[model samples]
Target: MSDVAALLSLARAAKARIATAESCTGGMLSAALTDVAGSSDVFDRGFVTYSNAAKQAMLGVSPETLARVGAVSEEVAREMAEGALARSEATLAVAVTGIAGPGGSEFKPEGRVCFGLARRGQPTQVETVEFGALGRAGVRQATVAHALRLLAEALG
Candidate 1:
């Protein structure tokens, strides 16, 4: 699951294309996926929705949802994943939103990330990972790693 090449191969074998919707990690998930050679067939596209406006405009994340639970919540992550899957030609999509930061409140701590995985004709799943104060770079790197795992698991 940590191996990007193996994950890509799994997707290709399943004929599953991938799309990503990222917030705190920016486009790091997309970069990780495309880092491997011959990923074009399985990696479809990515949306770096770093802002509330961008999330609404690009991924169709509901303004109401954002206002209700904020961008870092499971609701927003779920919407982002579903939105990405609906907007792309890909069969599978993953979304992430969180506070990978040097600043965070008690409600949402630093290194707290929410992930959503959506596959065609299947129920979308969401989970929260409290990576714990792993500095900014560490949180982001961990996010990309976990995202790769999510993609690999989704292939099954």
Candidate 2:
């Protein structure tokens, strides 16, 4: 089965609901989850916070955190996950923020993605990945796969 399908299966088995907060990947994560049959039972909602303002307004990612660490940082990802969990009726939440680009600075290179996962009663988890110049679509696809894996792991 696909990673998204596997995640949906696990979530359904556990009767857990999920939410997503996405930045560079846009709504691809949400689209992937909803692509599965009968995902509504397990998939709650999605926040497509593509901008710093949107992140703050939609997912409550603090402006201070954004200023301190930037949108692609682990801190913002964690807050996005936590905020999604708090705002939605979901039992679990996953977040992704990245610079999936053909352009990147010397410091934050292209294909550098940050992820966050949160379970209702558990500590929020954050991770950073360097996919290394995979281009925009490639990096986004990789991010979706990793995000699904994180959700599946949390379901376990």
Candidate 3:
């Protein structure tokens, strides 16, 4: 089984449901999870909040966090995950934000990603990663893979 398939197995065994909040990956994590058969049993819902305003309006991300961290930081990702968990009835949630781009900025640059995972009754975990200057598709694929791995880890 693929690791994602394994994650579904774990979640099913634990009777847990998961949700996702996505930005740069644009619901890719949710797409991947739902690509598997029987995912509806373990997957709850997904949010695609590509804009800072949508992040605030939909996922309850603070405008202050967006202003301070520029929508692609660990703080926003954490808030997205927590908000997804709170908004959905899922037991676990994952969120991602990044610049999967051929264009962006000097300091943040391309291929910079942030991730967050929240499980009900547990403190949320957040991390930031730089995949350097990969091609846009490559960076997005890597981000989805990494997010799936984090989801599997969280379920365990």
How many Å off is the CA of 33 in candidate 1? 0.6
lDDT of model 1 at position 100: 93
- TM-score to native of every candidate shown: 0.97, 0.97, 0.97
Give the least accurate 10-residue stretch of model 1, judged by summed lDDT.
1-10
Quantify how close model 2 is to the true structure by its C-alpha RMSD in Å: 0.8
Give the lowest summed-lDDT range of ten residues in model 3: 147-156
**lDDT scores in order:** 0.94, 0.93, 0.92
Distance from true location, Cα of 78 in model 2, Å: 0.5
Give the alpha carbon lDDT tens digit for every residue of 1-156 in model 3: 988899999999899999999999988889999999989999999999999989999999999888987898889999999999999989999999999999779888899999999999999999998987788998999999999889878778
Clashing pairs in 1: none
lDDT of 2 by residue, 1-156 (tens): 877788888888999999999999889999999998889999999999998999999988999999998999999999999999999999999999999999899889999999999998889999999999998999999999999888888888
lDDT of 1 by residue, 1-156 (tens): 449989998998999999999999989999999988789999999999999999999999999999999999999999999999999999999999999998899999999999999989999999999999999999999998998899888785
**Pairs with steric clashes in candidate 2:** none
The runs of at least 3 residues in candidate 1 whose Cα sits more than 4 Å from the true structure, single-residue gaps closed, are none
- Runs in model 2 lying further than 4 Å from the true structure: none
